[model samples]
Each structure stands twice: as C-alpha cells, then as structure tokens.
Target: MADQRQHVQGTLSELGTPLARCTFVIVDLETTGSRPGEARITEIGAVKVCGGEILGEFSTLVDPGVAIPPSITLLTGITQAMVAEAPRIEAVLPGFLEFAALDRGTVLVAHNAPFDTGFLRAACGEHGYDWPAPTVVDTVTLARRLVTRDEVSNHKLGTLAGFFGVGAQPSHRALDDARATVGVLHGLFERLGSFGVDTIEEVRGLRATPTSAQRGKRHLADDVPESPGVYVFTDAKGDALYIGKSANMRKRVRSYFTAAETRGRIREMIPLVEGVTAIACGTGVEAEVRELRLIAERKPPYNRHSRNPERSVWLRLTREAFPRLSIVRAVRDDGAPVVGPFRSSREAELAREALHHALPLRQCTQRLSPKKTVPACVLAEIGKCGAPCEGHESPEDYARHGEAAREAMTGDPHRVVEALTERIAALSAELRYEEAALYRDRLAAFLRAAARSQRLSALAAIGHMVAARREETGWEICVVRHGRLAASGLMPLDSDPHAYVRALVATAETVPPGTGPTPRAHASEMECVLHWLDAPGVRLVELDHPWTCPSSGAERYRDLTDWDRASPSTTRR
Candidate 1:
C-alpha cells in the first residue's frame, strides 16, 4: 500500500502540483457592468485556501470614478453612495494583489473566472501594474466536470452552494459568493476522488462528468499507451464494438468514458465494452488508415463510415449499341466513363437528371439496340430526349449526346454547366422558381460528383508515390499505391530520411493496379490521402506519374454552383 501511494505520487509529480501542496485564492467581484473596459469593479472579495483550510481573506470596495447605473445597483446591490467614500481601484489594487499572492505560484480560482480576471487585469493595466498571468481554474468549469444536471440544476456558484449545503449562501455580494464558492469547490474535489483526480493538473484537465458505468469501466484504459494509435473496444465475446484513432491513444480511450464523449451510440456501447486493443503507429495518418481498414473489415456496430464502401453507387454510361446512363453499385472494366461512388442513390439520380437536362440522352432504363426500334417515353414527347428508342434519331446523332455526357463526367464540364446555368437563368426569369430550384440542386450534385471523380482519378492513375510533410517531431512520410495508403512512417528529426523512406517502401503492401477512378481504395480513404497531400509543406519525394488533375475540370463551376444553392430564394422551401 505504501509502494502504491509512492508510485501514484511519482506519476502525479510529472503531471502537475498536487492539490495537497497547492494554495488557491477563490475570488469574486461585483462590477458596475460585464465588459472589462466598459465596467469598473464595485467590490472585491477573496478567500485563500490550502487543502480545504482557509489561510486568509481579502475584501474591499472601490470607487469606480463613474456613476453606478441603477441596473448594476439592482443586480449586485452596490449603490453609488456605498462606494463613493471607498478607496479607488488604484488604492485597493495593490493590497488585494498582495493578499492573493498569485505571483508566488498560487493558482487563481473563480466562478466564471474570465469576468473577474478580465476586470482585475484591466485595473492593473490602468494602474501601470504588470498582471501576473497566474494559472486560473474556473470553479464553474470544475463543477460542470464533476456534478451532473441530475444533482444540480446548473453550474452557477449559488446553485452548487445550495446543492452542497454550503454554510455560506450567495447574495449577489462579493464576499458571500466567494465564501459559498469555497464549499462548492471542496464538494467538487470529493467527487474528483472517484475519477482518481487528486492533482491540480488533473482538476484543470478534467473533461466531463463520467457516468457511474463509465467510471467503473475506467480500468479498461490502464494498458493504452500515450502515443498515436488505433484502438478497438471489444465485447465479452471479443468482437469489436467500436474503432477509433487518436494522436494520444490513452487519452482518447479514456475520453470514451468521460462527458466529452456525448455520442448516444457510443454511450450505449460503453457498458458492453469488455476490453480495449491498442495498435501504436509511427504517425497520425498511419493510425487513421489502420482504423479505417479495421472498421471496414469488422463492420463494427458503433463504427459508421468506411464500413460499407461497396454500397456506394455510381452513374455509369452503359456499353451498348446505344449507351444510356445507369446507376450502378459497382464499376466494370468495360471502359465506360463513370461519374461517382455517390454515397446514396438519390445523389446519383440528381446528377443523372442534371446531365439529361443538358443533353438528349435517353432516360429509359433498358438496352436500346440501333437495329430494333421501341416506343418512346414522355421525355421524348416534351423533346427533353431525342427519342432514339424509336430510331427517330440515328445512333450517330445519339452518340453526340452520350459523348458529351461522358466528357462532362471525366474532363471539362463546361458544356453541361453552361447549358444548365442558361436554363436556370431562363426559368428564374419566368418566375418558375420551384423548377429552377430543382435544376439548381441537380447542377450542384453533378458538379460535386464531377469534381470528386476528376480528383480521385488523377491520383488513382499514379502507379507509385511517396510524400512527406514536416511535423514538429519528425517528417511524416507516406507511400501510396494507386491512391491507397500502403505504408506510413515518421522519419525522426535530424535523421536520414532517404534510408527511412526506402525501408518503408520495401515493406509497403504490394498493390496491384485496380480498375476505375478509386481503384482498390475506398473513395473516402482516397479522399483522406488527398487531404494529406494537399496540406502545406507536403513534398512529393517520388512519383511514377505526374500528380495533376484536369485544368479544365468542373472545379471552375464550384463557386457558381455554391452560389446558386446558397441563394436566398432557393433556401425558402
């Protein structure tokens, strides 16, 4: 037991000053107004406490050198007459500063600290005194961390005082409130004991009030390392319940049981969590990709994304005698120009509508042979389509529309964007607002899909690549194979990066070339890779192909599409 206590103390010493060895000055102020520059202190009250024992007290009234408004007098019960004969802030400031002794490494305590400290700092500045800028702990923040709404109505000092049955009751005066806050602070300290928080640093770093279940399960975090990694929460049967990654594995795993983790699904999964598995990595991107891969493979109940990458739908121009646009769940090697990996079928349909609006593509969801004629649909009646199904339009003529649609998806979208924008303008001019809005949605969806497809294809076409970003600790290096993260490592600062890069490349996952824009990687995963590539200071160390996107791509239509969607008229319905 003695060894355990010594071990705990040694651990905490590295964290911060222990509460038992620290002195705290609990302060409260009655001000003429809220803003620091706009208001002056009417009264100041503080109690200095170390280990729950009051060491001293400081109280004073200050003449604001301005008339106290009736509203301020009503709220704090400090009238102009009360402070008219009191010492001015310049006179009262030094005595209070001396009594607080914050410059001697004492922690400052206050309820909603910014208000009181702001005024104090302003007064010191006005009086030509340097502000100490001591470590501040807000009791209001601590109360919210330890006490839940079930125990107290709010985090206000008065509410907490009543909840704790503190001897002093707050009455809008400075001294009474400061005394009441002392009891509230002690009560919060007792609650912190259950979470193993005894040091001032732990108190300052406390996140949220953990539920009893989460508190009981806190032991699960005992083995998690303090490093960048992926973590898995497993059930009694050893099946993964949730998967996540963080720069600090231990801290992130611990947060699952804290109030900082407020996701309803995660809270529900916590009780079932029987164990935690940690996979330490050399860099954040490596951890991220590992988490993505694990979640995709396990399809954990609490993990939402990358689990069903196969469910993504795409707009495909079918390869046939007369090709027609169709929404497909998977792409084929038939070399058809595809538009997406759209998250939902609805988005693919919207993109399809936008293309149909510009070109005379057949809306019929069937194989149309150039040799056999079929009945036309209503789209043909309205001239929205050229009725190629009836052979009224030759395949050569229909081919022009199909080629234009393909070009819009894979290359410059100017033709489709220009045609749709013109139609939107014409509709808005005629006050056919709803129809114009529908067209606007379709255009935006098309542009969004086109931009993503172009970006993904540009990267996916590359055979092999290596990139590095300068980080504080080292150079974050990643090896990419067809837009998938194959391997990643951090080259230690001041070390040889070429050798490390070679070693990482040699051990990377062997990736065979895959078909289509996203290849073997999920679109979302490729997007994450793209995000890392786009960050500042990222240098391409090696590449098999030129890393570039089409200069005439749909990216140019982004602003106009965004503006059309954000227009006030379209937002109403």
Candidate 2:
C-alpha cells in the first residue's frame, strides 16, 4: 500500500497553491438507511487534509434514539450495542459542524456528496444548528467525467479505490471509507492535470472533456479582453458564424468550447469557427446597440431575428382623396403619415381593424376622386365607413373623420381605445367571449403600435442630442440624431468634458438621409438610443430639439387595456 502522507504531499507540491492551498475534508457516514429525514447516522468519519498532509481526523458513533434494523446491522456491522453508550446525534453534531466550518477555502469531499451532506443537513435542522452550506465536491461526478466506462467498471467508492490501488479499503466502516476517498480524490486530481486543469475553479466547473477541435481553438480566446462587448464567431472563410453580446467577452466566448454549450446549432457552429473577434464598448447599453446594428448590417447566417430590415411591415395611411389604412412592405414619404414599422403584416392589419372600428375611414381598394360616382360597399351600408366612393358622404366631411383616425394612430389613441373598450364590454355581456377576446387583442395591438409610433416619432423629430451618465472610470456619452445612434464614447473623468464632447461630435458617424418610408434600421437604432436615454439617472447634456412624447399619447389608455380583472369589461359600459 502507498504511503497516504507522501501521495497527498507530492500532489500538492506539483499542482501549486491554487489546488495545493485548498483544504479538503473527506467525509463518510454509516447510516440506518438512505432517507435523511428518517434514516439515522450510526457513525461519522472525516479526514481533513491540506496539500496531502493529514491535518486532523474525526470519528464518532451516535445513538439514533431508535432500534437499528437487522438488514442495516448486517451491512454496516453496527448495532444497538455499538451506539448504546455513545452520545446522541444532537450532542455529536456541534463538534462536526465546528470541524467543517467553511472558512479559508475549505471544501467537503464525498463519494456521493448529496447522500452524506443530506444526512448532516437534516441533523442540523432537527437539532436547531445552522447549516453553513459548505462547498461540496462529489468524487462520483468527477469520476464520471474523468474515467471512461471502458476504463472503470463502475463509479462506486470501492471500485475507484481498487482501480487506483488505494491504501485503505472501504469495508462498511466510515473512517476507512473516508480515507479511501482521499486516495481516489488525489488520483482524479492527477488525471485532471493532463487536461491543464489546475485551479479550484477549473475543477469545480469541469463538465466534460473538450473535443480535439475545441481544444485546438482554445488559443482564440487567449487575447480576448475581459470586458463588456460584442463578439463575432467567424467561419474558416471569414463569414460571420454567430454574433453575441456579453458583459465578459473572454468568459462568454470560452464557454462555447465546454459541455455547457448544449445547443446543437451552436455546437455545430463552434467547430466551424476559425476566428473570434470582439468589439469593446464603454457601456453594456452601447454593446447592445452595436450588436443590433451589426446584425442588421451583416444579416449573419446564424442570426435568426433582427437580421433583415426588408422583412419589416408597416401600416401606411394612403395619400389619396379619402385615405384608408393599408399594410405595405415599405415606407414612403408621400405627404401622408405612417404608423409603423410593425413586426408583421398581420399585426399591422390588426391595428388597422381597431382604428377602422372606432372611426369612419374608407376601406375601399379603389382610389376615389371627388367628382367620381360609384356604388357604396357593404362597409358603407353597415355604417363602418363614410362612403366617399359614391359621394354619399361629402369629401370635406369624410376628411375630418380621416384626420381623427390619423390622430388616434399617431398622437392620441384615447378615442379608438374607448370605442374598442365599449365594444368588448358589450360582446362579453352577451356571452360572446371569443368575440370579446378578438376585440381585446385588436385593442392591445393598436395600443402597442401607437405607443411605438409616438416614441419613434418624438425621437425622429429631435435633430440631434447629447446624453451623458457618470461611470466609475469616466462619463458615458452618446450622440443621437433622428432616432439613430450618431456617436458613442467614454470620456475619462480627468479629461475636460467640453473638449471631449467637441471631439466626439467631430468624429461622430454621419447618418444617411431617410431612404425608405419605414427607415427600419434607423428606427431600430433609435429605439436602442431611446432605451438608453430613458434609463434611470441618465442626464440630458444637450438637445437641438426638445425630447418629448405627446402628453395625450397611448399611455393614457393603459388602464383600459387590462384584460385580467373579472369585470374589466364592465368599466367601459
């Protein structure tokens, strides 16, 4: 048998202080049974060691206050007589807790930690002693990862101890089993060293052995800075494989090589990643904005959403004699107001239905002239529209209602919201629950669209603005123009604020004039900028135009949109 003292001392010296300096207390318990709440611990054995040197040893027998089962006595060779003169569990638990106090980087090691820890924890709870939740390391978990099934018969303590030629053998005695575990633990440490695992953090975080491809690309993260930023994983041909944001670029990027990355898509992408690039940002918000812009510009193969601006749909008020809501794929400046940049045509149509239900807006597909004479449609007959097609309603009067509908879409949504609220209440009162739900969803969609429109409109009206917030090392500054991020940088606390501001403005990115009707890319950027500006404690440094949303905006109809109350529909009636 190997000298236990020499094996531990040798391992500690070679591994250095991070692993060497750790104090490991290997523990084992012989109990009446497996259930912690009901099973009583008959014997407790522990060996506390540091750097392979045994620092202390503890062993005790405890009276369970109950008769030991014949089966358990046969398995453990412990009976009622063995613990008859011994102190009760309550008396023995205090000393054990003190011995395992989790200060000074102490770690508790067991073959299967939960089994032993559970009994100890239950004893603490029952005896009214606080459980300190010491950091636990299970050798069984380590064995599963380190030794393959082909190399070991099983993960049992005796199996591992026999495989490693441990000095002490577990024979149903607590102290002998705990000593055997110490040997198994040292052997596992030696295996971990082959994979360059040295630190306690590495051991604790070790999930699976890295693949050869992952191991080869480990150097890609060597120079990645540990800061908030956006990271792009590129393929062998330099095509962006994936783009992600993280507070710690190095840590996040490194995680892709481990078993923690269970997403099969990401796993497939990882092996193809030949390069890793990081764009460092001053603040997390800046990193988020950059991620959005980069994804929009690149439309990277792996990115699912926010990849294509052309895919966006909008709700446009047509520029005609009698304007009607139309769902279009693009935005145009035709002298008529637009509400969205909505996610889909379906969502935009829902908002349109809500507005049409509340106002007499023409729904005809044909363009009508003031002098034209045509038959009115069923919508006109049902009073859903003021028919300008047949000249039944005068163009001037129809235009007035069109203006009200436009106001509900853009600035004030209270009128439309109130009308929908009453309609929903009436439907629910008649027990037409599905119809009421349909109207409720329509109202919610309109309210959301209106709120987005109002915010985007207000942001677009601001020609340019400068916002700042104090940071630990400096000030975070951003310049926004027409709802897009123009420039963003960090100004050091020691630098002149005015001079830095001027420098930032001089080097700010030139935003191109609005190309499409929706300007979805700029709108997305604007939303990002607005979110940052709205964050608590942000200071408005400068503004070419006042940052304001319509006071009578969609927010006023917030309470009317609640669908949770049992009688929410009654409020409108």
Candidate 2 lDDT at 457 equals 78
Local error of candidate 1 at residue 271 (angstroms): 2.4
Error of 2 at 520 (Å): 8.1
TM-score of every candidate:
0.75, 0.71
List runs of model 1 lying over 4 Å from the truth. 1-77, 82-171, 174-193, 196-209, 569-573
* Number of the top-ranking candidate, with lDDT as the measure: 1
Which TM-score value belongs to model 2?
Answer: 0.71
Candidate 1, 95-178: lDDT as tens digits: 998999989999999999999999999999988999999999898888877788898788888888989989999999999999
What is the alpha-carbon lDDT for the whole of candidate 2? 0.79
lDDT of 2 by residue, 1-573 (tens): 111233110110122236788899999999999999999999999999988889998999989888899999999899899999999999998888778666445899999999999999999899898888877889999899999999888999999999999999998889999999999999998887555566566677777777777667778887889888888989888888788787778866776675434456766677898999999987766787788778878877777666776666777788777888888876775656677667667768888898889988888888888887799899977888777888877878888887897788778888887898898888878888778877876887777767777788777777678899887878899987677777788888999999999998888877644532234245666666777888787998889888788899886776544542335344434
